[model samples]
Target: MNSLVLVLVAIVFFIVAYSTYGSWLCKKWGIDPKRPTPAHTRTDGVDYVPAKAPVLLGHHFSSIAGAGPIVGPIAAAVFGWLPVMLWIIIGSIFFGGVHDMGALFASIRHDGKSIGEVIHVNMGDTGKKLFSWFAWLSLLLVIAAFTSICAATFVKVPSAATSSLLFILLAIIFGFLVYRRGAGLGISSVIGVALLFFCIWLGLEFPLHLSYNTWVVILLAYIAVASVTPVWILLQPRDYLNSFLLYAMLLGGVLGVLIKHPKIQLPAVTSFNLGNYKLLFPILFVTVACGAISGFHSLVGSGTTSKQLDNEKDVKVIGYGSMLIEGVLATLAIITAAYIGQDKLAELLKGSATNVFSNGLGEFMTGFGLPFATGKSFVALAISAFALTSLDTATRLGRFIFQEMFDKRKSADEVSSNPLTNKYVATIITVVLGGLLTFKGWRTIWPVFGSANQLLAALALLSLAVFLKRQGKEYRMASIPTVFMFLVTLFALVLLIIGKMSNFGKNWPIILIAVVLFVLAIILMITGVKALSDNKVSEDKNFKA
Candidate 1:
């Protein structure tokens, strides 16, 4: 298979999906351009300020497009490129896009509330409380895993570490210029991009050398500040700036594929079992978690993006459209892995997916007339940017979860009103806990993180199904995906539990965490099922009336 053909096919499929099915979903969901979003109505300057569609899209895409999309496809490529590509295309259109759009719609309808609050509206208080804690823990796992991953990158690759630090500084300056000085977007963006490239050059020349442990502490400290700062101050602008680098890499890779027309050297289908591992049904589903459907996107949709949404009509674009873009990135990742060859991929697979992606992406960039070392450094910086965006976003979302959990019994006006459970307190607690979890190592946290992420997506889909049912709208769109993800993720959890129990003494901590996640998932599923049943009964009664 020619990589160019794969790239073209994926691009056409995504465009068709976005134009037809995405538009259909928007219409069916009744998107109203005239509707005032929370950003307009709530306008708190802190969390609910309206943003232009492009800017919000940048933040939303960058935050959600973390290493997961890159890593999942690369890791799951062992099942062969065909399986990975098929899942990315079909799943993005049907599952991931719908899940993300529904989440955003639910949150906006509820005045920028987190999905946990959405659960409360549809599934009752008990369900809300359970889901809230589940979401918080899932976010903590995200923060921990991403922080460790970024820290490791910084420790191992001094250029990436230096570039990332400079990126943060540049974000703050960019934010100040744009938000405070009222600078023009075009001018500020050009300057920001120029400075970023300079930093990349500087980082290569003067790299930062830090131990892994030190890097972890510094990264967590950065998260602490970034998560608590006003969205416009750091989070939004930083993501917007980082997004340029991401887009460049995506475009560069696509063009590289087109120019080089690399032959796909990897097999199209391998054994369902790889060594001691099985690449069959549920494992492939879980292994390819993010590229197809990620629960974390829901967190981002409801937790942060909803608050900044300027128009109801933009939800389809930001939520559904961004997901399709990720699907494309995932496809590119599959191509990168395939081009790396099975032998080298097997070796790289032993380490972080960042290694595989950077190396392969370096080769791709070389086709564009760049030195492999420089291209590798650039790719490494982009990966670091991706991880950092996800890190702070997860932290911010975790804060929202904590505040909601603490404020459960209160009225909407009083929620998070108490200083004790305020944003600052909640953020600090969330970051500290996540920092502790980071010490457990990314290798230890990733499996559970991936499973928990997919499980959360299942739960979010169920919440959306119930929301649609209450609206007297067609809900099979959400419900069917909900059921599928639920089963797949539940099966994955069971397998993890069995594996963990078998190594109980050596992995007791992880085993305990896995058990808790399993229990929570089972409870949440039961709650969702009951909610659907109750909604049906109510609809029947109303029909009789």
Candidate 2:
């Protein structure tokens, strides 16, 4: 089959779903344009400032896009393009879109509270505490794994290291100009983007040389500061700037596929085995978590985006629309991986999934008459940008969860109410823990992180279902997705525990953490199920009246 056909099909499916099912969801949930969003109702100016639709969408997309969509789809290509394509298309529509929209909607209705607090409103204080801890732990794993990945990329790719440093410097300057110096978004964005391209060129001309460990330390320190700062100053502007590069890369990939029209070299469906494990039923679900459906996205949705949402109607576009875009990216990733020959794909798979994407992207760019070196640098900058945006976002999210864990009132002021829960202190602690974990063993952390991420998604869905049920709104959309994610993620957790136990001597720490996650997931599931059942009974009684 031609890879272009797959791309076209995925694009059509996403567009139709966005227009039809996405609209249906909006109407079913009764989205009101006149409704005052949290950004308007609770304008803290720190976190809850009302952002323009385009800017908020850019921030939301960059935060969630990360490396997951690229990595997961490329890595899962061993199962063949057809299966991966189906999952990305179907999962984005029925699962990821609904989960993200529901999360954003729930948070806005609850004054920009995190999903854990949303859980609290529906399921009570105990459930809230448990969900908060679960979210925090999942974020810790994200910080650990993503920090190490970024560090390794810098060490391995000198040009990327140089470009990354320049990117951060440019973001700081851009933030100051826009937030303090009174520069317009139009002028600042143009200047920022122009400088970014120059950095890319400079990086190619004079690459940075740093040891892997040193890069890790630098990244951790950066996140510590970035996470605690006001969102507008760093997170929002940086994400908006980074998103342009991502959009260009996506567009370039699509054009390359169209021009080259490469044939799909990999099988349509292969055996279930992937390395030591099998890709049957639930394993594929776990492996392809980000591209199809991710729990981490719920964190991004409810964590920061909800607070910055300017309008209620924009939630569908930011939450559901961005997810569909990610699905498109995942489809392109699958096509990219498949286009590369089997031997090269296998070799690249031995390293980072980013390598496969970079190589495939380089090949695609060459078809457009660009030099391979230039193409490689573009890919590096794009991936580095993705990782960096996710790093600070996760750090900030971890801070939110930590602060909320202690403050029962769930007030926005609690973020700085005390030294212990102060934003700066919380961010430092989160980064320190994540950095230490990364230094100890990021490799061992990866497996558990993947499972924990999906498990969080399941928990977020359950929380959303409960929220919807209490409102007497249509909740089957959230409930069905919740059950599917819960079972798959739980299965993955058990397998991870069993695998860890088998290597107990060398992996005792990971084993313990895996068990903790498994137990926590079970407890949350129980709480969610009970809450759901109770809500159903109450709804029935109200209907009988």
Candidate 3:
């Protein structure tokens, strides 16, 4: 009915274009995303990347989607549907999608190490270390917030505990089948994915509860075990299984939307109240990445996903295309969100299902074939799935980064000098620290995920644009996007910082804390860039990610 709404529609169309157009460009350049892949490039187990586009896309999407899509919209909803929706469409096309695709292509082009490694080679180690530090901190916030989310849910729905165990055990068994046994990837993934559904069904049928403390411990234990295990055995299979779970949610969501056809009721513009906006520019960027742009996408791009490329040609599908799918999911969430009254939405979000997203999606799923009572629990489980998927992936990626930051320059052979150290110890260290924080409580840590996430997105995109600009021929296409992202994000972060400063004396501890973090983040980011610029490499020709 309004111009803004039309803008929203156009934005979505542009995102669809953003996802496909760049891929076409890459294809034109003769890039093959499916080449032997860096995972196979120098795999000794730890960095064993998958070469299949679909599989890696599954892994990347699951890891990146955690909490963002659900939480960001809810936060943005306060600002009204228009601003949030606009950002979602525009950010994804120019900011998130391009950043993700660029990072993926960058990593695949270089031998699949990480954004940190790439920066180190191009920018320098200090540059790498700075980004790495931010990355690890970002992940810690993620684990802490999500772990607390899971712990809190387990506290409420005790029966869900059994399902958690079921997932972990099932994932491990599935992992073994794929990694250790002679099981084919397709067949093993099929069985593994089926079991994931079975676990969810059982979780609903036989709910279990535990003390918040015990639940925290149990989840941490799972994280500890899950992180150290090789990707083939655990990460891959669980992620593979997670892929199915999410798709199921998508299927159920689409059908529910079609069948329910609920009416939209939220105001076109959320009241222009800047005070209640808990996060500032940078933090807002982080908080809203699920719907807009996300730094986590960059992490996944460089982490394990980059190594799996069978052909660089597929980068568009995996990186940009997968992000577009995530946007659609966020869109679906928003559509369902449009159904309930604001007061009712607020009430539902606060009660259970963790955040607005879980509650919204939970409600949406029930519209399909699920029972009402079970809907909330289903919502909780879905949130847990998202949290776990992010938690593990973030931890492993963080560890690799931490090690890379400190590890000395060495030949590729010497790089693996301590393979066990990277896979097991680093992962454990990351999980344990995060688990401890989660045990403390999510309410204490959750608010920060948005800020950290946005900060990383800002930095990563900048790095990507800079990297692209130096590519000469490629820079023509990338230049506009890169420069645009830099300006937009920089503006956003500046607004973010200003907002945070205003919140400095707020009564709300969380907002106050967020404000402080914003200051530090800005300083850290500046130093990181300068350090990178001063890297030993004068030409920026060599890169590691």
lDDT of 3 by residue, 1-545 (tens): 33224335644686658647765656533465345666666766756655466667777888887656766766556555666666777777666777788788778667887887666655555666667777877777777877777677676766566676788789778767666786787877777777777887888788775787887777777777766666766676666677777777767666565556556677767655456344334334444556777778888988878876667667887888877767766666565455575777767667532445555556666667787556666666766777778877877776777777666656655655555346567777788777766654654454456656666776676565455544432433444554444444445545544545654664244444445545545654565446434423235443322
Task: State which candidate has the highest lDDT.
Answer: 1
| Candidate 2: pairs in clash | 295-457
Model 3 / residue 407 / CA error / Å: 0.4
Deviating ranges (above 4 Å) for candidate 3: 1-15, 24-30, 33-35, 276-286, 352-355, 365-369, 415-425, 439-444, 476-545
TM per candidate comes to 0.96, 0.95, 0.85
Q: Give the C-alpha miss distance for residue 216 in model 3, angstroms.
A: 1.8
Q: Candidate 1 vs candidate 3: which has greater TM-score?
A: 1
Q: How accurate is candidate 3 locally (lDDT)?
A: 0.65
Candidate 1 to truth, TM: 0.96
Segments of candidate 2 deviating more than 4 angstroms: 409-419, 440-443, 536-545
> Which residue window of length 10 is worst by lDDT in model 2?
536-545
lDDT (Cα, tens digit) per residue for candidate 1, span 1-545: 89999989999999999999999888777778888888988898889988888889999999999888988888888888998899899999999999999999889988898999888877889999999888998998899999998998887689998888888889989988888899999989899999989999999999999899999999888888887889998888889989999999999888778788889989998767764435467778777878989999999999999999999889989999999999988988899899767898989877678888888888888888989999888888898899899999999899888877877455656544466478889988999989988998887888788889999999999999988887777789999998998888888778777777766887787777778888988998998998897745232221111
How many backbone collisions does model 3 have? Answer: 30
| Ranking according to TM-score, highest score first | 1, 2, 3
- Model 2, 381: alpha-carbon shift in Å? 1.3
Per-candidate RMSD, Å: 2.7, 2.8, 4.4
Which regions in candidate 1 have their CA more than 4 angstroms from the true location?
A: 275-277, 412-420, 536-545
